[model samples]
Target: MKKLALAALVAVVPFAQAFDDKDEAIAYRQSVFSLVATHFGEMGAMVKGDKAFDAAAFQYRADSLAALSKMPLEGFLYPGADQGDTKAKAAVWENTDEFKKRLAKFQSDAADLAKSAQSGDLGSIKPAFMKAAKNCKACHSDFKNR
Candidate 1:
């Protein structure tokens, strides 16, 4: 069931976008972030030995994160997306160039993680995953409110 749901998400991710409505944009980004957290956490469990490492599953999650990494940025592009029920700080919209740079780094890191996961070797995947994970912390520190 989980695999089926993830497969559905992978299929839909390329078409996902923020709506023109401010509320909808907020919802879109939040939903994307939620999915990102879910997948990232799942990978973390495998990486940290909390969960049995399934190479195939790890690769799938890494690939999903790579796809998801491309989504939230579009949601932030819509006006008023930083307002309303969101944890995104004003700096997301205020420091546009920096925000974009961080997001681009995240996207690149995610892709690298996915590529590393393809080897089905934990040694290869760990550093890539750490790099990708750092982007999350960096972005949250600079752009998201606690």
Candidate 2:
């Protein structure tokens, strides 16, 4: 009887009480996003003349960005379930179409950066890196936590 009662309680508990699908997806996306942002920023510094352009470092970061970009788009799909970090505003769901557009822009910019980096030309990389940074900034400014 005790075991039955415990099982019943567990079943009745909200998804958020465990690892809700929505929260899990959000966390996963954020983790990957952080890595993408960090490497992009470092690459930006190198390209912008703030730091010497180190070929090995740039290649490493660019590789990371390219790999991260290839992650399934499903990770970005939020079902409006549990709000874990909840840094994502209600506006995201309300303006679903626009949010998706912004995400596409980010992906496109990252792709451009990846291609430029592969060219092994510092001059080409500098502008492409800057464009990628701008895309990241635009999305974060409008959609992300301050």
Candidate 3:
């Protein structure tokens, strides 16, 4: 009976492993996009609010935002090749060069934001944040599903 149980366990492990891998990939993608949205929202708050500026908080979040863009875009490659939860439009594949250009723009803008945040100047931060936000919005509007 022990041998039979062991055999059964071995048989089920591969399926479980596959499921876990898929789940992890999905979660990672969700995390990336969620962080992007969250940081963007924070920038909006800082710019729109009259509250005192927090340089530390801004720098921390800006650094995170910049680091996120550096991650391999492999998440953009889905297993089934279906759209799934991706808001990425078909044009992303069709107009590959344009998509790449937009992604590069976003990276550049985020890097600039990070540099500006490091300067500890609220006035500089505002414009940098605006530039980053514009790149993000433009990419989403052009390539994202909705």
Candidate 4:
């Protein structure tokens, strides 16, 4: 089973390895954001004690989330036309400056969460995570299609 899983991951890695064009870049960024969501959800569960807390796992996920935080905005800056299905609304392109500002704030919050999580203090993690998550909510509320 492990080998099968590894094989599947290997198969998918190539497609995710590079941003080929505007469409591909947008898709790639969206994929990275999905990973960010997954990691953050796992960490949130641990922090709230919905799951057993593992400091190492929380830190790892925090770090992964932080790394992915830096990705999505690059897609917003894609040079050419968009060709993929995106939940991003036209407002993202129209208010490009504001979108960039929002992304920058999210990145800052994500980094802070990562640093706090890395300290291995569960108490600090909750507030930091919440603050960072609000950035996501704000962006989605303004710029994403529902």
Which regions of candidate 2 fall more than 4 Å away from where they truly are? Answer: 1-20, 70-73
Name the lDDT value of residue 127 in candidate 1.
Answer: 95
Highest-TM-score candidate: 1
Which tens-of-lDDT digit does each residue in 70-128 have in candidate 3?
A: 54254544453234555567887678788777778888888999999998888889999
Displacement of residue 63 (Cα, Å) in model 2 is 2.8
Q: Give the TM-score of candidate 4.
A: 0.81
Pairs of residues at least 3 apart in sequence or in different chains that clash in candidate 2:
none
Global CA lDDT of candidate 1, please?
Answer: 0.90
State how far residue 75 of model 3 sits from its true place (Å). 1.1
Candidate 1: stretches off by over 4 Å? 1-20
Clashing pairs in 3: 87-145
Model 4 per-residue lDDT at 51: 98
User: In model 4, where do residues sit more than 4 Å from their true spots?
Assistant: 1-18, 80-83
| Per-candidate local distance difference test | 0.90, 0.74, 0.74, 0.82
Local error of candidate 1 at residue 90 (angstroms):
0.6
Model 2 lDDT, full chain set: 0.74
True-structure RMSD for candidate 2: 10.9
Which one wins on lDDT? 1
Where does the lowest 10-residue lDDT sum fall in candidate 1?
A: 11-20
Cα lDDT tens digits, model 4, 30-139, are 88888988997898788778999888998899888887887777676666524467888888888989989998898899889989988787887889988988888889
Report the error of model 4 at residue 111, Å: 0.9
